[model samples]
Target: MSQPPITPVTTPPPDKGGDDMATLAKGGRTNTLGFILRLLGGLPFLFVGFRLYGVDEMGRFAAAFVVIEIFALICALGEKRGLAQRLTEGIETDEDTPANLVFDAMLVSLVVSGLACLLLITFPAIIFPNGTGSDFDMWMIAAIPAFALTEILLAAQAYRYDIATTVRARAVVEPWVKSIGITAFFFIPALAGGGIALAFLAAIYAALLTALYSFLRTYGLPKAWRPRPRYLSKMTSRALPLIGADVIERGTRLLDVFLLGQFTSAGTVGIYWFAKEVVSLPQKLKTSFEPILAPVITKNLKTGNMDAIASQVRQVGFWIIALQAGIALTLAIPGEAVMGLGGPEIVGGTGALAILLAAEVIASMAVVSESVLVYIARKRNLAISVGVITLQGTLSVGFILLVQHWGYPEGFQAAGAAAALFVALGVASLVKSLVLKTLLKAPVSNWRWPLVWAAAPAVIVGFIFTEFTPEWVEIIIGGPAIFAAYFWVIWKYGFDEADKVLFRKNVAPIDSDLNASN
Candidate 1:
């Protein structure tokens, strides 16, 4: 059966931008739902993990997993960034897009994955190393095909506005499945413990199988899947910068974790990972919006609709900052309670979580620029990324050296790492926003409300909560109230009539905004 032609939504008439902001805020809400799903998926794994393996053991499990993941990220370099562009023009022009892009994408994916596999094979000591255990090494080998296949197949899903499926498959089902299976394995005969790696390999393959089927069902099978030699060469040329961009982006995120494993104990990596996860949930929660935002911004750029482009750029940024600031305030204010959630040994991660969240607070702006620039000014965008990541690498390595020389506390090192990340991201955000202003002629100033209204209120509320509220009670109850009150103030007072309309898009725009007049 043939599907209806894909239609791009008409741009809302830009004004004060209340309704438009609301619509995209709603997109953040959807991302929040995806986050909840991810949390639900992760909790089962977390609970089972703690019960079965405990914190220190779980940390060791994470060591091999991080390397395998970094390898996977390296393999994904080009294909991920380039997909949004390939379909941008076609989606907007209402063209009969060819299915062959999938094949071309897959071919590129295969070559990269093969290269990664060869590297892993040739440098087993370098890749898996001697200390992380033979079980982990074996799991990495088993996981290579599954990780590569699942990630490679995900681009087509992004092209189709089918984010919910990707969300369900990865964030929802996969983790949940891993949790349940691993929890059961704790009772397995003779295998006394340490099945976490095996559980992950199983869950990943399950996700891979499901994702591949979903892609095939949505788009027809690979008739045009194979790229012609000439066509392949041309597409590869366009993708080169993106390969560099993705390497810098994903590589930097994983680089620290990999290095921490090498220099520090698996236990330190565990504490660091715990803290990073707390604040990162919100960042990861918002990630679902990236796929949708990418195509929309790319299409707007292709059509030269400056209004649509600016509106989206502003709206997504506004929404992301509002949400992340809320999460960051929660983590930073009562930093102890969040870290304590993992157990007493992990309490040291609190400072790390606070710093990482602060860094993510800055990074939210850069992520908005990441999607917008990829379509509107990919070359300029890529250059900014190169600069930022270069800055990050130098700062990270140098800071770690400085800290090692000083012999600081475990948590102090995390704080320094987070501090380094904050500085790097803040600089990067400024550069990218400036680039967007110069090239795309988009107003970076439109993102100011989030910086001022949202960030200010949350910071104030966090301060008040810390000072006035009692310790254990505040974390248990008052902590949540602080978060709630801050958002209420901003969403009610900070947001104007334009903001109100987004929630009430189902009703008349005026009706939605006026509801706020109360």
Candidate 2:
């Protein structure tokens, strides 16, 4: 049978540059709020899990989590950014809507996730390479489907410029559930051993439910939707580059843990994983711009508005670098105090924590550049991603082995892994940003002298507290002082009226145009 001719959905008219900035700012503001909430909510779980569960158990959990998240990202098929491009390009028929398309991605993800669960179930050793703390550890793979589906649903909402939904699900519901669940489950004698893993499962499902509610509210049910295997195969094939990019990009973060689980002890992995988690808070600032950047960039691409894409990328890149730099300095300067909060045992990871925080700051440019490159230069972007993760993996292993050969402690090994990440990410940022600038035919560097100006006072303030004051004072009073000093300089020198848009609360709401047809 012959298929009907496919027609592209007519694109919406481009909004003024100001409106685009407003949309990006709105997303930044919402996710920035989410970042704070995530920090507050996530810290409790870290504290309780380390102090209550102990480093060895948490280390095992961290190893398993690395596997779970990697597989989950694979199952998601890169819809985190790809879905926005798909929706922006439009569906094939009148009967098929964005809801139907989302369902397509979800259905595929579920099938893959089920297979993944079965594979892990057949060989539980893959997840617990060292050993399991409790019998219930095997069930953690069940969260894979929920985690994958949540990514799709959240990406769908982001297509409508609905970042608040992501904020609510990821920042508010997810972390709090895990934190509370970990604490609650700890008290039950039967569940205490596996409470951390159980809490993680609960959090994944909670966030999925939260995302589904908002998705249905916005997109409703699919209208006359039906499965198409041929179309699905095509969709999956088209997403290969994106999938590889997403997996490899995330792999760099987890590869260190996986390698360490083999080369070092479980407790060492726990300390290193704690540092990764702490640095992830600032890392979220870059990703907060990604979902929203996709739709805006795709819309501009459809119209040949390369300049608009370049401008948006620069704007978002600066915002991320500035915010991440300040946060990194504040945390890394008082690194020992922050790491000690998890427990004194965790204080050994202070060096790793400082290096990982710096890595996040440097990676911001690569992150923002990839947002544009994924659309205009998918293969090239994927190539760069592949290259960097390979470099990161090699360096991580080499560093760990060298440190071991030198008779260094496990803490030094962990810091070695972090230093590897720092080098790889700095290389990635420089190369990726250059590629993006070349492709866009415009200057795309995010660096500004004001960043140095902003950091100088922050460094001075942070050094004062670290040298003169107590740990509590450094964390409580000095952290804020560092932030204030950095941002004050940023506001006075770095920000123009456009950059100030991120601070404004009264911008017009960014709404969906998904239901439009032309």
How do the predictions measure up, each by TM-score? 0.85, 0.94
- Model 1, 198-299: lDDT tens digits are 678778888888787777666655452445788777877877777766666655565666666666666677778777666657667446567556555554
In order, the Cα lDDT scores of the candidates are 0.65, 0.87
User: How good is model 2 by TM-score?
Assistant: 0.94
Report the lDDT tens digits of candidate 2 across residue range 1-518.
65434333333346766678788888888988898899889999999999999989989999999999999999999999999878766643443688888999999999999999999998888888899999888889999999999999999988888899999899999999999999999999999888998999999999999999888777778878888999999999999888888887778778888888878899999999899889888988989888777888787787787777777878888889999999999899999999998788888899999999989889999989988887778899889888898899889999999999999887899999999999989998999999999998987888899999999999999999999999999999999999999999999999876777789989653332211111
Which regions in candidate 1 have their CA more than 4 angstroms from the true location?
1-28, 54-56, 88-98, 134-136, 190-194, 224-227, 446-476, 500-518
Range of the 10 consecutive residues with the lowest summed lDDT in candidate 2: 509-518
Runs in model 2 lying further than 4 Å from the true structure = 1-13, 91-95, 507-518
